[model samples]
Target chain A: MSFIQRAVKVPPNSVSLEEARHRVFDFFRAACRSIPTIMEIYNLDDVVAPSHLRSVVASEIRKNSSVTNPKVIDMLLFKAMEELNNITEHAKQRHHIIGQYVVGHQGLVQDLGTKDQGASGFLKDFYKSNYF
Target chain B: MALRAALLRHVRIPAQTLNPALTLTGGKWGPPSLRWMSSHDDHLTKSEVTERVLSVVKSFPKVDPSTVTSDVHFQKDLGLDSLDNVEIVMALEEEFKLEIPDKEADKIDSTNLAIEYIYNHPMAG
Candidate 1:
């Protein structure tokens, strides 16, 4: 049996040039202003600096220059938000050593014993000092 | 020693015979203001970059400031892993207010390299 796939057509030039430019500028401005605060709060200052974030945003804007439709903008914004949330969630999970430890029997043995007793001891000491 | 003395003698002759026009200007072209402005922020010098980089490295809670030096390697000498290296590079990007490309950022594995990179970067302020 043969299957046929349908191609979807996208409308071009849906938004005015001026409107596109304004929206792009607004997006960048909002991103730059909030990125630093976000980095600080998330303890991401070490992993990604505000300048890096700005550069990434600028590149993303440049890449999507042809996108002017409001619906597309909303979709892109939603996608970006999802990506940021994922990064934040991943960072939060990775920030704690306990979260990195495996739960299954073999995984637990590998982490606590096979992986180096010194590191496990250090983790224990760190847990005691920081948590208790 | 002889070369040093000869250089000193040449310098003394110029100082003793200071240009009359320069003296008559009454310190109009004095270097003090130029030095002050240069230190204030017009440029990023090697020493300034070194000091700032050292301070940032020292600010890490796990790092001992006294152990930091220009010659120290981020991983080999400082015992920082790759993630810590990323953090340090990010901190440098923030301090210099410049976006270091990932390719270049990856190469900055030591305090000395960071100092050199910042000192040579034309856009660094």
Candidate 2:
């Protein structure tokens, strides 16, 4: 009940790139702070530590590092916040968290050797998840 | 009116005057060391804070452990970007169980500053 109330209370849109940057850091801190509860709810203790999860979240944000527009950043932040809210609220099941964040885009087989060097790009993508 | 004026004149006090006893005791009884017992006495030493801060920085995945030192800059020296800087600060916050304000957190760009800030923080433990 309170979670819904808190979720709906959005701040005004950031007017400048600087403001948006600060907001991103705030969001990052908020996400990092919630790692404990997320781990507990999803039973991720054996799989991931808080620091590792923090790095993963950082890397996810780093993927979009080229974006310079404040409005676009705000939109992206909203989506990230929504995803965080869902995860923390237990809207996601254990396997969902494990698959998306824990197992990662690499899928189950973390090939470190040259076995996949000869495989076609399509086959590699097929082996990986459907998402880009 | 006359009585009131006389009372006012007699009751006036000087600005520079202070209680001698209060000054002698430093506002409390006994010597300064024995005046109060607190957990602050066991605050983390500078060496311990340095070692812990270095360990946290070295443990960061992007940072090369061999390149990390007590005075290394997160961005300029370690080749990390701004986001990595924030991430390292967050890691330090978790390690120390301290919630550093964003303003102060922003200023901690190097290992020296992180060590100094944590060492000086009274509630860092």
lDDT of each: 0.62, 0.88
Q: How good is model 1 by TM-score?
A: 0.40
Report the Cα lDDT for residue A3, model 1: 12
Model 1: residue B75 alpha-carbon error in angstroms: 0.5
Q: Indicate the residue-level lDDT of B50 in model 2.
A: 93
lDDT of 1: 0.62
User: Per-residue lDDT for A22-118 in model 2, tens only?
Assistant: 9999999999989989999888999988998898899889898899999999989988998899889998899888877877888685556698687
Give the 10-residue window scoring lowest on summed lDDT in candidate 2 chain B.
Answer: B26-35
State the lDDT of candidate 1 residue by residue for A71-95, as single tens digits. 6765565555444444434434434
lDDT of 1 by residue, B19-62 (tens): 67576335766655545545445677788888898998898655
Candidate 2 regions exceeding 4 Å error are: A109-127, A130-132, B1-38
**Candidate 1 chain B weakest lDDT stretch, 10 residues:** B32-41
Candidate 1 regions with alpha-carbon error over 4 angstroms = A1-34, A37-132, B1-41
